[model samples]
Target: MRDPDLDELRAELEEFAQPEKKASRSPREERIIAGFEEIQRFVDEHGRAPRHGEDRDIFERLYAVRLDRIRKLEDCRTLLAPLDRQGLLSGAGTTADAGSDDMDEDELAAELGTINGFEITELRHVRPSAEKRAAEEIASRQRCEDFSKFKPLFQKVQEELDAGVRETRPFELKAEIRPGAWFIVGGQKAYVADMGEVFTNDQGRSDARLRVIFDNGTESNMLMRSLQRALNKDEAGRRITEPVAGPLFSDQHGDEDQASGTIYVLRSKSDLPLVAENRDLVHKIGVTNMSVEQRIAGARLQPTFLMADVEVVATYKLFNINRSRLEKLIHRIFDPARLDIEIRDRFGNPVVPREWFLVPLSAIDEAIRKIRDGTIAGYVYDPQSAQLVRRGTE
Candidate 1:
């Protein structure tokens, strides 16, 4: 009962709607493409092509090796040419190639499996939960998008370290994890850019998240507790102390200036053989808010005064500065000449006297003058020369 012309018209339309034939690739070809894509992802994330080196991450080394192999094979190059938007093939590979040319199908598969996501059972040696967390936290580092903004800061810090304006100390407490604080962990400088609001955890301990940026242009948002544990575990981890700043002394204290303390240079009057032999060179550098005479009273009764009366050789009044930090600075400057002699206190206990140095009064005066003018950071106390010389000269 149907018309032949109408049925013929529908068949024509269905024939025109058929999909086009697609190209087919074997499993080997598919695997090659997938591996190349992984290398491309690495380049995209790190802003550089992976290179072979002992210091590089394991996965990156594998990628470097695989890239070299792919470049050697004419077939792989032809297949990957269309996808080489990063011009990875055009660039030269690193000279530090490792391993043999025995990258068979099974070995390549194993390498690929070791990357991306990791399984606990795959680890050869099991680690504790905290250690595992710390490892994972460090491994999660990625290229920082705003690294250019921090490059200058890292350069400045390096300069300060070279000039003796900054010092590295053992990291011992969680209280040091504040914003703007810097540290050296895993052989890289880490700056604490920001920290989240403080909160107590189930263990009744305060904790917070930190945005830590690294000198290698990487960053991580690890927890404060996690960073603390990482620092404790890393042997090279250290806290970068803040550089000394502001004027150490002021004449005719202004109305707005707060009197901090005075830096007093004292020569010990101890009759010990070493002290008597080098009395002129044996001096105590101290900072105190109390009167110099009052602080030195009953010197013979105090172990810190070396159980001997002391003569105040010089004093420089300070304003609006941290007395303890200023004292630490002077102590560190003259630490090489520190008196190593030990004495017994009135209680019959052995006590080591600190703040006493074997430096001459002339050098101490020069250091005080440089410190007042903020040039002390560029100089150091040279025990051999018996003078304050430029830091690099010694």
Candidate 2:
């Protein structure tokens, strides 16, 4: 029951079919024929015919196998059949449809419906999870990208230093003697000759010792001034100057502002030997009743704050203990916001938050002994109850 016109079209197509040849055609001819054949096949498969109107040039290239050879009329008919079925060609395959190749933007817009301007803008600004993931991946990738660019410059400087090239000089010294001491005996020593020789050998030695003592005192004074300036620049010194003044206990009657505080400055125990001359001065600051300002004025000294008794209550371990837990064990037990938790070592060193606590010397010794014996894991205190609780015991 197939259409007679379609049957005729198939017969025409068979007639145009070229016999398979043992040898291949020239590359140029093959390329041209392949291009036109693809178009013809597309037309036939879709039940549409090929158009020869604007595509005349393309057809000519495909038919340019040999100018001398007779053109196959049946091949032309077969090529035109599909165009005729699709109404794309006027006569089988002579002309294309009215609007086949023309695409109107307005028409397409009408078919797809109007796009909202706001929606477009929103899409551009919005970032999906995938986009964030991609950005993180890109950043991580860039961090490890290349170090070869900087390696050469680094290696050159290292090599020069290794070769004994002088890169820097950190210190310099200048010296001078007192004018009167310049001429102790003769012509060049005439500066000191004006003075009578008042010393025997022993006296001269004593005079030298006196000069040494004066020089040592002067040097010590200068060094202390420098150290004070350095301490003023330290972080702890700054914090002490800006102490977070707050009320002590609920019933305490003393003016919070009247609370006396001191910065206990001490060189490390290991630095004791190096600072033997200042040992007496340091101890004096700790035991004396002089205010920090008065002490500094009297000795021209700068002191570091004593951080020994500060207790740190970390938020993470706030719940691990019982009665002495930071804040409280349960509701109505402690108000975290009201209670101040600071950590310090036994000898009173101000440790960073989450770091080891500095408690009184007495507490530290007991804590260490208990820890060594595996009796406790940590130390906690309840200010309200005035009690200390070990980690493992109730």
Candidate 3:
């Protein structure tokens, strides 16, 4: 106890050792420490740091402000020194920080990478789920990356369509939908590029994800069910397929090939009051590819001819005619003046004749001429005037 030099040597050794660190902080330091810790917890939850952009949630913006103040405050930085495991403190108080005001809008957007150009300039839409899917199917379109491979296929398809080998039919619900199929949608021909996996929903309906490329330099990632719905709603939608037979129209030679169909106009002879009263105006019009005599042989036995004797009013030889199409056109032209006459057949059963019309033969002759001249489509039969007039004039 009397050794002063030895005690002084011991005290000097103690001073040379490292001092112990502070274990606690003051109230002011603790307040800043709590605020900074809250922000750190947010970063731990969301993979990125908080941002002050207007697109962010209000709570996120408030946390972003708190984080900014905490970073700039020296006391707060010192209080939370042990929590900086990701080196976030090194970049604090700089323009490169997440919530820094010195950063430009473009720079901040590039950092987040959330919105694209399409979403930025678009407005919101509300619709039914089926209609919404259809809208997205058309609206969310893009240029296909690998369309070069499909160029040749489209060219060949066009060639086949021109040659009459491939034709379009009405889109059906039960039709086979698969990859590499072509369909008419939104007035454009779309080709199914690839089909993804087949998935079933809660309702047990099957569907597939598809990449549909259009002729207008656009494409979409659509579902099979969506395509079906869109096509069913569209009046013009059709499926493109190659038929087994060859072209519908081909050049023919010789007199036998040049033979035209026979257009026979017959007047029905009936004892009924309605038929006898308008026998002169009511005429039964028919077209046949075979001989007119052979066609009239079964006229008396059939109910279509009123089951009575028939008078041959006029016969014109149709040249190079489509018999079925010609008959339909003739029926449509006289549809307005169709005569509603009923007569009892040989068995005394009441029957109505459908083909009899109370129209002038001259008008019928004029319609046939207009059809032959390729101008019938421009006209419509006016019931009031009992004459053919320009379609829009009516």
Candidate 4:
């Protein structure tokens, strides 16, 4: 016979061993759940699921992709039965990207998220662009075991850039894009250090292999022609020169090869109710080949202007710079603060004006400064924190 205390302890242990009523969700299931929640939030705010188009928010496009992937998974749909308040799993909801029950090409295009003219769908029957192919090839490159040999070159470049001894210039694609040259590819400073055996192509063209290293400690062995093709397609790509024989940051307007454009940050001068309400935080960013005044002179009548007078808040001059690429980068950094409201044109047709975000003026100024110093690449604007934060660790 056991003592009463021992018997009581054994009973308590047995009771504690019983499984709970709910099972913990797996990582995959959790992700599916979160994705559905995000879609529901979009539907709630916009009164519909996120739509597909080049002009639409990239977040919405990504959500459309996620919804398509989830809707096809029967297991996911079943798992989300209780958590899904929006009937996302019932098959009753139509794909946001997919057009109405009528058109054929659009029905397919909706799933593909075809932006502007670019084919964004994962499953494509058409041939891929040369840029896309080259980008994929470069992306597939693994870590370089010999990164140390090239590390010093990047260090020296950074030091010279800091000391104002060397300056970067816009890249122009040429056949002489050979080894021992430095270029900015894929938005990262890259150096071509070595060349492999030359080979002939079916078109009677000569090309050679190259060992290129990026400032981010990554390297690749992409072909020479492939690098040129990639650069030509890249609007922001540039080639750097070895401490050119000139004064640093000098006015090179007469050089004939310098970039000719300006990046202008503007704010509306309209007394419109909405504009008045968010005037301080609401800002528009754009690039113009002409003076900002010339660009916005007729803004009051244009749909792109949201029918408002505007004032230039800031301006950054450029030389051989890709203005569109720079504008895209600034917009991307402040994307989290993007305003979701739509506007109407003078003709009463609905207009969705982009490039406007709810960021503070000081933050915008700081961002532009960071861009000039070339330190903006690794940083992103945090709307919640209302400041810049380093990528990844955030």
Worst 10 residues of 3 by lDDT: 114-123
User: What digit string (tens of lDDT, one per residue) describes model 4 on residues 1-394?
Assistant: 7799999999999988968678888766665666678778887887766655432444565566566666777887788788777776664555565442222334334444443212342334433442334233333344777889888678766644543334576767565477778888667888888898888855567877788887777677677777887687778887776644232123455465555477777888777677789898888888788987899999999867778888888876666555566677678779999877677888898988887888888898887666655566557888877788887755
Query: Where is model 2 more than 4 Å wrong at Cα?
Result: 1-303, 306-361, 391-394
TM-score of each: 0.45, 0.13, 0.37, 0.42
Deviation in Å, model 2, residue 140 alpha carbon: 40
lDDT (Cα, tens digit) per residue for candidate 2, span 1-394 = 8899999999999999998877765544443344345444555665544432211232222222211111233543344444334333233443334533121322211222312210111223223432332222111111212334434423433332232111222112111122122111110111111222223332232111111001111111111112223233333321110001222111233343343222222221213232333322222112123443453342211122222221121111111111122111111111211212343544565443221122233333343233223232234444333334653453
The reply for model 1, stretches above 4 Å from the true place, is 1-13, 16-247
Model 4 residue 230 lDDT score: 68
Candidate 4 lDDT for residue 251: 45
> Comparing 2 and 4 by lDDT, which wins?
4
lDDT of all predictions = 0.77, 0.27, 0.66, 0.67
Better of 2 and 4 by TM-score: 4
Candidate with best TM-score: 1
lDDT of 3 at 308: 73
lDDT of 3 by residue, 246-283 (tens): 21223333464444477788988867677788888788
RMSD value for candidate 4: 21.3
Question: lDDT at 115 for candidate 2?
Answer: 24
Question: Top model by lDDT, which number?
Answer: 1
**Rank by TM-score, descending?**
1, 4, 3, 2
